[model samples]
Target: MSIREMSKKIVLCFLLTSCTYSINAQVKDSLSFIKSKKMSDDDLLKKREGTFATGLPDFSSDPVTGFGFGIRSNFYWNGERTNPLFAYTPYLAKLKANVAYYTSNARELILSLDVPYYKGTRWRFKIDFKAQQNPANLYFGSTESTVGNLRLPSDENTTFSTYAAFDKARKTLRPGGVGEAAFVTDALSNRFRETEYMLNLKADYALGNGKWRIMSGYEIQHLSYKTFEGEEADAINPITGEETSAPNGFSLLQRDYDQGKISGLEGGWISILQTALIFDTRDFEPDPTKGYYFEIANEYSSKYIGSQFDFNKLFIQARAYQKLPFGKRTVIAGRLGIGNIFGKNAPFFEFQDQWSPEGSINSLGGKQSLRGYRANRFLARSLWFTNVELRYRIAETKLGKQRFAFGVAPFFDAGTVRDEWQNLNFKNIKYSYGLGARVAWNQSTIISFDYGISKEDKLFYVGIGQAF
Candidate 1:
């Protein structure tokens, strides 16, 4: 069986299953084992669920709007493991989608699909797409352990449309996500503008029980002035979607259209090919209690791939999870990640340190990475970051027919950034710490609320699963 054959079987099976009745009343009692294995890396997470979802607030450095709302959902189904594409391995297929609307009249969409047990003894694959239009000023400078966003408050002349457009892109989002445009900043105007668009495909094959694997992917993206997205950036005013003074000077704060330093300022297609070697042994993925995961990869860009510039990217990362002795309910998790750009022509936007390399353009800080500080708060040519968290399961209970477990986590994060590798400093590291509570379903899906404080600022986030 090939990829096409496997897909056909999955579709046919779904059509057949649709004719069946709900099994809640019949099967609810059979899942006691899932509830008992609260701290174990059980196989339950891989089981099919009709549909699951969660939502979070989108907050930012802008004061105009305290927050926006976003929703994430996953619909799972059985995929044909017997298909040659999967090498007759067991697998599950799911569609993940997210849509968010912001007060700045900005919107974002993230969609993707996964193959069964991407980390299991089978083939792994994914198709990802993301697009966002955010117009806001970001903290972009050369510094360590510090971040500064535009403090330029809205004035009487600063109409609703102006502020709304200025705050479309938030400084941070929970767990995983997309970002808005980046506005250039000037002494008189703390604003700059940029747009982000991307699409990519990837596949990986396992070497041993999915512990060792090879991964490869390709992507095409555009990041530049909001105007390049071919959207009405100011014709009718982005806020009310009606004519306003937004087309004028006060409304258009700062537009530093330059290509010398920030390669994508003018915005064009950035194409790249990437490959990696992965080693993972976590008992479970979402909220692991024990095991280790590691990866190293190289990404290259050139005119041959339609990239505007040429460059090579390298990343080496690792993590470990441990369950305590007194009770498996108590666990500790830690991670170490480092990234480097080998080419001088690599676009600055591409240097953004991101949590997941499958599709990330930024680096260093954010809700999913370094909690306390804002996203993209710190970016250096070469840098390393580390995170640690202590999780304690409080107890277990039931919600209707669903199983639930509640817990808490106190976490700490730190990282070092330098203009170059030789400039790395062991004594200088930015730090942050915080506490959070977790609510899980079937002991697999985790929902969390965390409050992190750092030298720069404090951050509050609610999202799915653990940070790593």
Candidate 2:
């Protein structure tokens, strides 16, 4: 179905469901989740008991992915407040499930589970399963090569001026022939379809004093890629003012494969063994008010481990949160991270992903990273980034047994990529600034909306939990 038709149906479904539930309970309480106040660790743990659940319509839009619709549900079981682990973990047990589809032929199904102090021991366990596909994933080349006048206009101009300029450049490079140089100028060169299936299992055992942990995990992942098929609608050829057929994918990825710039275009298995050292002192896992979190994670993929390719990845990250004494319910949070990949046999798809003890952070330009740019807008073997936010809670209220708090955060983000460590420089560092609105539901779930602007793009995002 067309995007418009699908959107209409989704809206109708949401309205019907909302009406059916709203009449039976307060609309706000039924739709939103919980909140908490600053308290001593013992006091905070004492108040969390019983079970809490919340489910919401996952309606969102993105510049590259178009409109998305789905459902997200979170279930939390805190057990009795008297449980010893209550003082050490966010929840005794939790489960999250999400299913979403985007207009750009991108879709995802994810199921995750977390249990801290499992079986009343110091061990914590986590499992995550995901299946996802994206037919229009972005790929703007790597490192310094990605910078230049390679971008097409975001909007068509009067008299097709931008197209006229782009076509002129294409002709200058190829002299009537569409070679690699000329092809790279086309917007279509930046997209290729990919499907990924992943399963992750992890365990962490708390050490003395419960402030340090040893983490280990394993992941099974498979990926495949293809060029888009079928023809697109015709568009005006600015040079001749005549219509020209718009072709589908078959862009940069195909060109790279044919030229041997990369390998494993058909994709294969990538089994990874991971380990990390973690130091955490955050007062709360979901919304930290004062503390620090640090991790140095290493991942290895080898033929002996059943991986089709061989490579090693290292990621280091540090985060801090401090509640301001001068402002009511205010906190300052910051994160710094750096990562690199070793070995010549790593698949191209592996370059854009960052892994840690918590989970995977895909690319440096998306809701989780650059914010203002499209996902995977930049790619390379080495990357570094930083994020800072000033968050202030503005309101709080209770509806029946459910508690909620509203907050706003102003944030700054900066990052860069390089093909190798030797090529890294301070020049051409991409940065963006933005503001975010947050809704704290119960104690663990946070609904977030953010809008960011950079020199190249303006984008908005809506999701669960903080960007970090």
Candidate 3:
């Protein structure tokens, strides 16, 4: 089952393409007036009402998505102008439809809508819904995760021979024997077939001053997960990032092997109740220049919530941004996040996937976070990650009425997952450093491309919004 490309050859009207133009216009116009000293930031905000941005790929591909593309739109409506120093608190509605990827073995098509509305100064309501059919999904035996458990079986009793051969060839910086490459892919990235649909509704109520808020949401997810006939040909041999239509060997999962303690291989339904505490004082929400944001959230899914399986998860994240006075346009930002899953024998799929705010990656070993590795490249019981970015605005230009900035970000990321959940040690951490190029549309939308390099792997990332 290919997650239906939903295919490379779908059709869309002008509403999608024109929104890109609209966003460019607003940003350029605002910047022109500001540079000429003719308009104040407040005046620009007043005129910045009803700004929108959208992207429709001619076609695109990533390591995970194989060959995928989509169209997305974000609408920014000026909800209120309570803070004079900051831009408008936008009432936003985001819509998207696209083919995530397709291959000889699996594919996925996704359609989703996310809407957030601010009611007065006290309450905000939001809804996120998505439907996807995914086949040949990747899994690295992390049911009861432990560091390096998914690596090749190294014990003398059952060691794989081809792994050693590839290790030797890697010294030459080459993708070695096709058989060795295909074997490694089968052993590591086991495939599955699943159809999933999720819906979540969230509410945020401001407390006392507007900077502190309480967040709550109800989410229901349906997953029809099952084993698939393993791919016969490795069109995209995951281990080496090589494109060869060679036959793939049997994956360990197809040999009647299961990764974890819990048993939900057939998939089930989970209803989640999530809540969080947020403290934010950022100068801007999209790409903050000053101030910091801290949030801690929990997800509880139980029999009481109608979950076919029960589990709970805890998440804590913080980010800070500051401006350096020496440069005309320079800022530094850092982010940290932690995730833990506990309670009744947690199912493999229940741990975490596709819950990110941007419909991007939430997995630790992915382009969005740990850029150097493949998606879910590493997994364990608990995860912690850090990101630091130095941003420099290189140029500012206008087209029609849209003002935008071309920027560069040199970033460093460090993260690791532990099976036992103990101390953070450098010996167990994975480090990656990278640089990114971006175009910011009125600080409302950002299109970025990043290239990351690590000791073991290198990756290229293309996506919307900041990596946080």
Q: Which candidate order results from sorting by TM-score in descending order? A: 2, 3, 1
lDDT for each of the candidates? 0.59, 0.71, 0.58
Q: Local error of candidate 1 at 165, Å?
A: 24
Residue 9 lDDT, candidate 2, scale 0-100: 81
Candidate 1 Cα misplacement greater than 4 A, ranges: 1-67, 78-91, 117-121, 142-192, 226-259, 355-362
Score candidate 2 by TM-score against the native: 0.81
Error of 1 at 191 (Å): 4.9
Worst 10 residues of 3 by lDDT: 31-40
Write one digit per residue (lDDT tens) for candidate 1, span 117-137.
332224567888989766553
| Residue 235, candidate 3: alpha-carbon lDDT | 48
**Candidates' TM-scores?**
0.71, 0.81, 0.75
RMSD of each: 10.3, 9.6, 8.7
Candidate 3 Cα misplacement greater than 4 A, ranges: 1-47, 61-66, 79-86, 90-117, 143-189, 226-230, 235-250, 253-262, 352-361, 423-426
lDDT of 3 by residue, 16-122 (tens): 33222223444544322112112235324433444355554635553333564445555444322332212434233344544554543334454544333232235
Comparing 2 with 3 on TM-score, the higher-scoring candidate is 2
TM-score of candidate 3 versus the correct structure, residues matched by position: 0.75
What tens digits encode model 2's per-residue C-alpha lDDT throughout 1-468? 999999758744543332222122353232121112123453373344767777789887754467999999887776554444445457767779899999987999999878765655567888899999877677655444553434432222312223245434322211112332221223344567789899999999877666688999999999998763223522346457554544432355666677776666789898999999998877778888888889999999999999998899999999999888865579999998888989876777877778887667866788888877667776788888889999999987777767778999999998888888677667678888899999988767889999987776778888888887
Q: Number of clashes in every candidate structure?
A: 16, 5, 12
